[model samples]
Target chain A: MIVAVIALGLLAGASGLLLGFAAIRFKVEGDPMVEQIDAVLPQTQCGQCGYAGCRPYAEAIAAGEADINRCPPGGQNGIAALAELLGRDPKPLDPESGIEKPKMAAVIDEQSCIGCTLCIQACPVDAIVGAAKHMHTVIARECTGCELCLAPCPVDCIHMIPFAPSITTWKWTYPAVEVKAAA
Target chain B: MSALFPFHGGLKTVRHKTESNQTPIQAGILPPRLTVPLRQHIGAIAKPLVQPGDRVLKGQMIGQPDGYISAAIHAPTSGVVSAVDQQPVPHPSGLSDLCVTIESDGEDRWIDREPVDYHRLHPSELRQTIRNAGVVGLGGAGFPSAVKLNLAGRSEPLATLMLNGAECEPWITCDDRLMRERAAEIVAGLQIMAHLLGPAEVLIGIEDDKPEAIAAMTAACAGTSYEVRPVPTRYPSGSVKQLVKLLTGRETPVDGLPVDVGVQCFNVATAYTVYRAIHCGEPVISRVVTVTGQVHRPGNLEVLIGTPFAELIKQCGGYRDGVERLIMGGPMMGFALHSDEAPVTKAANCLLAAGPAELAAELPVLPCIRCGACMDVCPANLLPQQLYWHARAKEFDQARDCHLFSCIECGCCSHVCPSHIPLVQYYRYAKNEIWAQEKEKQRAEQARQRHQARMERLEREKQEREAKLRQKAPVRTEVVPHLDPLISVPSPTKGEGSGQVG
Candidate 1:
């Protein structure tokens, strides 16, 4: 009995030592899971998910404090990707967050812009460029269509326009296949 | 027949060549107005050189090549620029693009022509000249020929320079007629390409269906060290990768080009253009187009670029009775045109006005029974069924893993499928979706980086503002050490009360 106990004890102690060594040798620097989740989330920085930005939402997701469906800008595909990554069942996006919409470009009515710099300060991606008291303009390419600048505009000059697919941006749609009715 | 290496899974489709190749290529009449698209070749669109009101000479550079991979555009005839505006161009999608409309002035005036000696000029300079001449692959790809002539990233010793005279797509006889007529000029162009590449062997692969072309090309290559080998007639044998394999026995890497296998291939028509550019100092203002299908005269015509399709069709006696579709290319890989009003770009090799008899019967698409027929006919040797399934399910990543981009969209699988499934369409859709997703990911990465930079800048600005305020506020803070403790805890209520009292 004592020999068996001693052998078991040595085996357990050896494994423990190996694991302890591995913990230090392969120590991860930071929360890499957060980074992975952040990569899956579209970095719109819209703050529709009740978080400051996509990164914070990703952090909350990593901490299990936020649901994956909260990212409306990310859409159903993003939720599916997150679910696949986290090994969870995919769910529909939360309606309270906002419904998925077509890609939009924020356009500023330049004539109506008061030059107050409110929209510039409110822009998350700094796509709006202008000096203080100068007429501000939105860089259409850089604007994420986040609609973050709309609420901050005192003169209500900011407008979100749906981007129409041009020849370069247009893509071929799925081929129509005839579905047979089940007998 | 030589011992040629065969590629996998090709079709033995019906050849509609005899209908078009019997007659000699005729010169097309100049239309009243020519609308040339800025984006003829694949790359950045050429920048407009003249405004709407400016007069342009025939062969004058109207659109300058914008980037390294772009090709220049020239006026087909001397005329005033009528309008530089958006118009319908010949595309699979009936969308409009920026076009340079020129009103033809009866006199086909020429720009000053300076023919350069290719032997004396450097290869790079020659390539630049070819690019300036707007010469592109006339095998329906429309890629800038000079870009392909460049041997920049190639590391291996050049093995073979294969000229594709295959004209493998059924109903397209432009290359065949060019080979039969202008063999010597095409050979001259091949020599220039060989001088640039320095390949060990120069080969020409023509489909066996065109015997006259083979004899012509062979006779033209008599004194030169160029071989004209006739490959067995097969659909898509004209594709770059397949032709490379068939002629040189080198299978191009799946995600790579023909150059990766130490081979450079060009269409015979492209060679002819190269010869014209260097020997005659002519830019690519015209190309031989096969006006076949339901047209009254199903023959080849050397139509000028920017000529309206309707005019060219009218030159061929217009559309016949029961004209069903106006296709831009061969029936296999071509797309239906909504209107013949679209101008013919450099890529318009064949404007097939397909009748009801020429088109495949509209069969209803059915479910796949896992029949390996599609796999048996795919030229790229990919499993089309699985690709179709993944694409249908929107499982793009899985489709990509199945080597979706390797598919050349040759439509061989679709042609052979018993279920009548549009397999190539699914593949095209999947490829486009993947490209769109990649572009979105790149945009997102850019946004993230900009956001981070903006945050850092704001933080830095706040710190600088605080430092400036501190600097402006006094050295007296350090003078009284006892006051620091009291100042650290601000009594906001007392201060507000004192301000109210004041």
Candidate 2:
């Protein structure tokens, strides 16, 4: 038993040491590019992209996997600048994606409200605050400005109004087209 | 074909070609008018050379080429420029863009023409002349042919010039008709392209479904160093990349072009146009378009560019009863036309006037059942179900890690989705969302910079104010009060917000 114990102990010690050395030797270098991309991404966590979160999208951008134009929430400017970062020709927001328009959130017109919370159920991000057969109001700040709530209201009580652009939410316009650099 | 180079994974899509491909392509009678869009070719929108109230000859140039990458617009029939403003264009979005409307004088007269013996001219001179003739890809891609032919001189070392006759799209039969009717001209164009690229072997890749085209190409290419290779009809088989791989045994790396693989492919129609441009000195003014789907009498018609969809439909015997979806091009990857009034452009290959009985109406999208159907048919080897999930959930980052950008939006995912979900639409949505977020961030940075500059200006003003106050005291022996009554001294407030360095 003692002999077997010593052999196991030696094996464990060797493996532990090797693992420790590897951990020390191969530390990951975080890229500033990822951080820059992350700063650009809208952190709505809408999961509109296949990624788990916005950070993964940023990481993908840094890795040259994600196109800048994929973000509906980020809109046109996001794609243009992403084209800037990747040093590729900036194409218009692919029409395959829906055209970019001013953002608006669903506003429940209380007077027309039949107290049917159908709009509440349709709210993907759960920005609606109301009860069944009672008046509903939208939490504007939490809304992703998707306007999904407008469709479900049977009586058309829910109306979409344009959201004001804030300093924190604004983006730079696409730069003028220039000759492409060698990748 | 070598087993190592065999192309695979193609879907047997429904063919609605009986409506159009059965009849031989007919030349259309002269129309009352035509509306030519300046940006007909691949490059920038050409500048308008003729204005309204100006009379033009049949071959008059209306829109001049913007740059080397662009093609010029020509008058299809002798006409007067009625309008050169925004008109409804046949795009998926149904938006209005700049167009030149010409009212035909009904006299189909050709201007005194000049022809060039391309065999005697140098390759560079031939290419420049082809550009001047406004020859471009008659294929759906619409890339300037002169620009593509010029790439032969690049050190990439091209080995083959392929004539793509694989009209794989369900309803479009333009390329097939071009090969069937104008095979010799296409061959002449191929020889011209081969001369430019020198001793480059020509391979005409036609789908097996188009045996007539294959036979015609074979007969036309009998005396030359060209081979007509029949490939299996596949959705996207006509795509330049897939055709190249099928013919030359080369795979173009992602984001790289067919030229990178030592192979260059052109549409059979484009090749025929090059022949016409080189030999007859005739610029591309018209093309063959397949009018099919729910129309009463459907067939291919050689129509002039900028002719309204209404006119084409009228020539095709109009729509039958409840014509629902009007798609420009094939059902697989075509854009839905917004209205019947929109004029057809160079990119339009087919106009599908689908009714409820012929084409199914868009059904309500259900949750994905994870049946793995999307994966089985994805040409790009992507997990479309995962992409749909991320797109629905707005998890664009995860989609990116899964190579979302590589999803070519070919509509295969949407086509095969058992859930009836418009998967392509979702992917597009995800892409747009990600783009919007990036733009928002950029705007914020710009705003921050502007705010910073304003803060700096305020600081400088405060500093100057203090300096003046000190100077006044120094000049007035520490107790002197007023000097100039015209200027009143105002004290500054202390509250200054710190700026974020952009």
Candidate 3:
């Protein structure tokens, strides 16, 4: 009886020491899952996910504090990808978030005056470039169509325009009716 | 005779060649207007050289080839440039594309012509000449022939130079007629290609159904090393991979081309055009098009590029009664065009005016019963059921893993499907969606890279600004050091006193 008890006690101590050493030696500095989730995000930084940025929302989702379907810009495709990655059931996008739409970019009207630089400050990606009381232009390639700058612009010169399909971007639509007779 | 290697599954479709191949090739009437799409060949759209009101002569280069993979566009006949804007093109999308409309002057004048000595010219020069002449694969692929002749820049010796005379598509008889009528010119083009590539052997694979075409080609190939081999008639047997397999007993590797196996194939019509370009100094402005099905005078017409379909149909006695749909290419792999107003491009081989009896009737789509009919006819040997399931579910990655890209979109699976499912359409949808996703991923990556670059530039600028400020105000740092002792002495004295007490 004594030998059995001592053997059990020794085993427990050894396991406890090994586990403690492993905890100290192999501890990860940051949740890698959060980084993975952040990489998959559209990275608009629109704060529609109730977080300040895409990284923070990814962190929240990784920490199990936020749902994966909160991002509207990502749409159903994004939700499905996230679900696949996290090994969870896919869900529809939350209705509270905005609906998914075609990719768009912000275009600024140069004719409008009174550049107060409010929009420049509001832009999260620094896509807009201007000085005080001067004409400002949005870099169409850089603008993610976040709409955060739209409200801050006093002149309301900013407009989100959907990308026009060029010859290269056009894809063939599915045939409406299948031919049943063989030629 | 070379031993033939059979490919996977294929069907023996009915031959409708008797309708169109019964008569000799006839020249099409000149239309009042020609609306030529800039993107006739597969790659980049040709750049327009003429604006509205510019008078262009016949065979005058009006649209320059944009890049390496593009083909030059020419005015089909002497005409004034009416407009260079979006016009209806013969595509499955039913959308408009940029086209150059020419108003015919009826003169049909040709530009100054001079044949080139291809033997004396360097291979690159020959290729450039061919490119300038706007020669492309007339087998409906419309790939720039110069690009294919360059052998993808591989130095390995070419083994077989195969000429495709296998007009396996049921309704298309243009190639067959070309071989029968213009066999000598096609052989001359083949000799030129052989001179360029120096392949060990030259073989022309024509279907046995056209015994006359095979005999003509064989007689033309006499006194030369080129061999005319008759292949079994089968649907899609004229496809480059399948033809290569049939003639050489070699299988093209998945995700690889025929050239990788030291074989190169060209259509018989493409060879004829090459001969015309090199020997006659004429660019590709017209081709033999099979105008059959529901037309009163159903036969082959050597039609000019950019001639509207309506004008061609008028020459063929117009559409007969019960004409339901107009299709471009063969009935098996062709797409239903929206309007007869669409112009004929270089890629169009046949303009099928399908009637009720000709086209498949619109039937209610039935669910896939998993009867394995599609599997039995799949030329690529893919599991159509699995592909359909995954593609319908938008599981593209899984579909890709099943060698989705290898499928040639031959429509064999859809043709044999008992359930009436458009298997080819599903495969096309999945392929397109995957391409779209890949493009999106690329754009996202580029954006991320740009953002990182912008951040790095900003940080460097900030550091540079600080350094410049320090350079501009050297006196401030000297003054600060002198005043530092006065501010620091009391604090150090207090610290020293505390240390002594401790």
Candidate 4:
């Protein structure tokens, strides 16, 4: 009985040592939970979530310093997803962030652009490209419609426009009644 | 007759064929204005060739095929282009799209035409000619026929080429009339298909209800090796997969084409158009559209592609009293059109001017009782209740797991539901949402990649700036003796240096 007990004890001790070594050998620098939270974020970098960017907001959420309902662009669906991930009850979006709206992109009026580069500096995602004293243009697909660059634009050239639905983007609307009527 | 295979589920709904088919097919009167939407087929919308005030002859190309999967668009009659702008199209969305409006000159003038010997041309060239001719599936799906014909390029040897003539939808006799009146032309087209695909057998499946159509087609196919097989009259038997199953016992793999199973199918009307294109050197400028339901003179009309639906209704002696809705296509899978101002496109098969009695009264929808009635009538063998449940809950992934794409939107499930749930609509909603979600996900992924790339680019620039500063420090020290001490001072440590530099 004593020999079997000793063997079990040694096995446990060896496994513990191996685990400790592994932990030190492959230590990850950042909190993996924060990365996961950031992944769930809409990544708009809108800063309406009471944080500087999506990653910072995710870090705050991971640390329990911020609420999950802070993101307006992610809206209710985002909260639900985060809640499911964290095993928390889903909550309604906090109204201070803003209401959900269709995706919009910043369009710069080339004629009105004064080449101040203020809008370029304001973009967090580096979606704007220009040199000082040169006209700036937004890389439309890259722009997250965060509206961060709007306030900095002196010329008011940048306009947030909703995407127009084309034939490729068109979807069928739900039918009302449930009866077969010959057309 | 060959032994027929039974499909999973179908409805024996009232066949209202006689309401319109009692009279022969009529030639549609030319409307004053024709507003043709460039996107008639399923692929890329045709690019406009004519501007406002430009004169075009009948059958002249107005919209050229943009891509390999696109079909060409032609003017229905000799006309002067009035406008090329957004107009109401015959779509369920009721949204306006780019349309080419033309004012007909009433002359119906023809452009210079030359018939091409399809046999003399190369196979690729022939397919291109057909694509240029704007031939597409006339059986509602409107898939470009040229793409469908290029099955020979696949590794799988072609086995069966089935021609669908089963006008199973009620009150739509366009295909029926086409078969009865122009069976020989359809056979000629079928011969061309046979030569292109070189299948082992050519089978034509027709519903047993139309004996005259069957006899006419049978007579037309007597000399050739093609066989006209009449299947049982069941609703939705005309659907591609169902018709394929009824004719041949082969089951098409889920999310796979009929060509995957060594079989390809085409509608009888598509074949007739192919014949016209090859023999008469014509593009698809017109088609036989059935104008039935609550009209003084209900019959099939050979309508032009760009003719307005309002004009076609007028040709049918106008609307009767108490017309509740105007539907496009058959009742089983048709959509309610908001306006008669919409123009007829290539996909239009039937237009129903339905009255209140004909349409099901707006009844209050009850919750599903789980009666399994919808399950029994699903031709695709999908559990509609489960799809409806998941779809209603917006759990699209779960619906997808249940093979949601297999549901052909046949409306059989909706027809059999005691709950009066628009099950097909729910499925459609779910599908569209899933598609939209997928597109959003793709866009998000692209944005993430771009963000990462920008971050990398910034990091690289910062490193290059630091390296340039380190290299220039010694040079500056040598040039100025008094400032040598400040310039030659050793750089700060790596961590502090980057922070100080910024």
Candidate 5:
């Protein structure tokens, strides 16, 4: 019994060391750029970029599988952010993702909704709310401004208006301030 | 402001700077149509001051702000707003943004515009008028200048209005040229800014690399109280924090603004805009952008916010061949654009048409060797390698502890990375993952709240129905808990196949 136990212990220790050494030997160097490209991405899960989410897009950027301009949600800021991270020249956003447009959110007029929950089920972000046989409402903050909920609604009660910018949701845009004439 | 605070993380990558700074800043001729996006400056999307059918004069206010934080959008050219709908804007997402398309009227008529003579107005009045003119920080930060000028804080104004002429990013020459050519106006703007933010001295910090800019600025500020100081040419010497450190010898505390050290820095361009805003009745409608890189003709062109990249590129004689990427700013910290269709925004200082020949065909990214090169030049003092590890492993908790949020995404790490592991990309992914997860968590919490409410309502209604049923049958007493008959959840199988929870 002592001989058997000693043999088992030796095997286990040897295996552990082997595994540790293998990990260091086979270690792959990772690109640290994925994070910066990711930051410029819109946190929206709206897979408008064809990726499941922003992280996937970041992965593609790091992997060179995706173009930085495909993110419609991140807009120019995202593109600039990615360009900055990659040490590449900042470019215009890709036209394929979609053009930069006024952001909008879904709104449901309860008066015309007729208690249909069609939009509730269709919403990828679950922004549109209401149950069957009950009036529906839109949770604006939760809405990704993707406009997905509009098509699913059986009645034409849903409308996507221009996104209203409040103090909290607003981000600063660089001003076009021209330099002065030299004194 | 560096008091040797030992900011422990960052990388001083090879500053490529081979293209732009080499040439004397040149201006592109023939002004084209300028499509101005309404929400160019941050805050509320300004209401259109001009309609699609209305003929606007150059520098005309096309969009008016509804509130204080908002800025007015101006007509880049005296033309009709061709369209006032969603046009492709220069955003990373490449999504269409609200813009006023102006087909340029070749005349470029100067509408009754007057420049503010700063000496005539009181400092407070000058600030208000400048705010009314909608002048904001020309630096990429894009902070509202009015708020910065009117310091609600009780601290004595001890900082100098450091005019940043050090165009740190290699290919961007908008500020450098502005300093070189328009030194007097820039100085005048600086003087105005100083008067408004008084007790503050005027220190125009130009990089030693641009001796012409330094000489011009020195010449401009000779008779005025403003002083043109030349600093060592560093990659980010123009950064407000770094310049502040060089000038005042004070370190802005982490997570604190330059104002914390009783200092406020303004870009030289911003000062120039202040001068124009106070002097001319012009809102910040147009800006000078460096249009260079792999193009036939490259020069600095004054473009209106919302001018399409295609137009700008066309004006710059277009790309020579193999245009790989279209970036909105300099190579250091700009966006690699997807299309040439996106319009210029207020923030776009440079437009680069770099193809695979210059930008290079993207190679596969390797892994981080942990040489700690990224740590050497990080202005933020963040452990980028630690962040890279946590991000790759999806261990966001550890990344947060490493101060993931403070990373300015300056691309310093990626620039110095030997293995070409997009270090910044990893950190970005981690941050986005965490942010997405947070949003998901919030959504989940919301769903839970809704579910809980529904459950409570169901319970209350069940009790109410039971109470009603009691009035009908007093002797037979079991309250029916099944709500299948009351609330019918519809199923896809049609009305006959109802979702009944028994």
Candidate 6:
């Protein structure tokens, strides 16, 4: 009886030591869930999710503080991706945030731009370029179509123009879904 | 004759060759106006070199090649630029592209010609000259031929330099006429390519249907190492992959090129243009286009680039009665144009004005009854039904796994489908969707990087500001000692502050 107890004790201690060593050896630096959730985000950085940015919102979600549907820029597809990643039920986007819309690129009316740099300061991605009191323009290719610049423009010159399919960007549409009638 | 290798699932499609090939290729009439799209070839659109109202000479460089894969654009004839603005071009999307419109001067003047000796020049220099001359594949896709001539970076030595003379698409006889009329010139171009690529052997594959072209090419290739082999007349046997298989028994790896298998392919018409570029000091300003289908004179015309399709039709005695949709290519892979006002591009092989009799009747698409007809006719030997099912369900990954990219969009499956299902359209949709998703992912990654960079910048600025404040705090502390006496005097006034608070 004594011999069996000592063997069991030694095995338990050795297993505990191994687990402790493994914990230190494979220590994760940060919350990987936050990074994963952030990766699934569209990264528009419009901050419709009530956080400062996509990362902050992702952190909140990882911490079970913020809901996944607060991002309207990500739209329904983004929400579905987030739900799949987080192992949560997919839900409709929160309407209070904003309505989902087509992809848009902000166009600065160059003639009317006041050159105040307010819109430049408001842009999160630094897609806008201009000096103080100069004509500011938005880089259409770099612009994430975030409307954050529109509100900050004192002159109301920034226009959110929806992108139209050009020859280069045009894509073939899916064929019509067939509905068969009963024979 | 070399040993012929047959490919799987090719239809014995109707040969509409005689209508256009009977007559000799005639020089196309110059229209009053020309509309040249900047993006005639694949890759980046050529940058416009001339502004509006600039007078350009024939063979003058009007559009400079923008990037490595792009081709230069030259003026077909001396003319004054009307506008460099958005205009309609012959694309399946029916969208407007930036085009340079010119009002023809009617002089048909030529610019100063500087024909280079291809034999004396290095291969790279020769390729540069060809690229500057705007030589591209005249068969369907206008891929820059100079880009294809490059053999650098390939580990294997080029074995066969195959020239595609198989005008396999029905109703298109441009290649046939070019081979028949300009066989020596085509042979000369092949020699130049062979010199550059240093291939072990040169093989020219002509569809056996065109006896005249075969005989002409054969006679021209006499006393030379070039061999002209006639491939069996099969629909899509002219396709680069199928032709490669038929002639060389080599299978181009999926999502790879012919060059990957030690073979290089070029269209015969492209070779003729290459010869012209070197021999005649001319650029690719014109191509032989077949204007058939419900036209009075259904023949081949050497149409200038930017000539309106309407002008070609008018030159051919206008459209016949009961003319149907105007297609930009052959009946199989061509798309209906929204307007004939769209100018002829280098890729315009034929302008098929298919009538009701020529077109398949508008039948309602029925559900697939598990018919294997599409699979049987697929040239790539892929399971068309499985691809269709996955594509229809938007399961793009599954479609990709079924080698969707290998599909050449030859429309063989669509032609044989019993249910009249547009199978090619589904593959195109799936391919396009995949491309769009890839672009979206790239954009997302870019946005994420920018956002992260901005955050880091803001944090660094905050740290710098805090450090500066810390540096200035010592001065403020030193000055605070002088204000100690004033602070002691304010201690008596604290009673007044407390009474006010109460």
Task: Please state the CAPRI-style docking class of candidate 4.
Answer: acceptable
- Leading candidate by DockQ: 1
**Cand. 3 TM to true fold:** 0.88
lDDT on C-alpha atoms for all candidate structures: 0.89, 0.75, 0.86, 0.88, 0.71, 0.90
For all predictions, the C-alpha RMSD in Å is 5.2, 15.0, 7.6, 5.0, 14.6, 7.0
**Inter-residue clash pairs, candidate 3:** A181-B360
lDDT of 5 by residue, B477-496 (tens): 33554533464332222232
Write down the worst ten-residue block by lDDT for model 6 chain B. Answer: B493-502
Off by over 4 Å in 6: A1-18, A177-179, B476-502
Chain A TM-scores, per candidate, are: 0.93, 0.56, 0.87, 0.82, 0.69, 0.95
Worst 10 residues of 4 chain B by lDDT: B493-502
lDDT by residue for model 5 (A14-99), tens: 99999999999988676557655655566555567888666677788889888778877667856766786788887887787787
lDDT value, residue B11 of candidate 2: 73
Docking class of 3: acceptable
The sequence of per-residue lDDT tens digits that candidate 4 reaches over residues A106-172 is 9899889988888876776778887777788989878899998899888799999998876567886
**Model 6 lDDT per residue over B1-502, tens place:** 6799999989999988999899999999989899998889998899999999999999999999998999999998998999999999999999999989889999989999888899899899999999999998889789999999998888888999999999898999999999999999999999889989999999999999999999999999999989999999999999999999999999999989999998999999999999999988999999999999999999999988999999999999999999879998999999999999999999999999999977988667888888798888899999999999999988898999999999999999989887888899999999999998889989988998988877676665555556556555666757776654443211121222121110
Local accuracy of candidate 4 as per-residue lDDT tens digits, B180-248: 999999999998888888899999999999999999999999889999999999988998899888989
Per-candidate TM equals: 0.95, 0.67, 0.88, 0.91, 0.66, 0.94
> How does model 3 score on DockQ?
0.25
Descending-DockQ candidate ranking: 1, 6, 4, 3, 5, 2
Q: Give the per-residue lDDT digits (tens) of candidate 2, residues A7-54.
A: 999999999999999989997689888877776665543345556456
DockQ score of each predicted structure, in the order shown? 0.46, 0.03, 0.25, 0.34, 0.03, 0.43
Candidate 5: segments with Cα more than 4 A from true spot:
A1-183, B1-32, B66-68, B117-125, B434-502
The whole-model C-alpha lDDT of candidate 1 against the native structure comes to 0.89
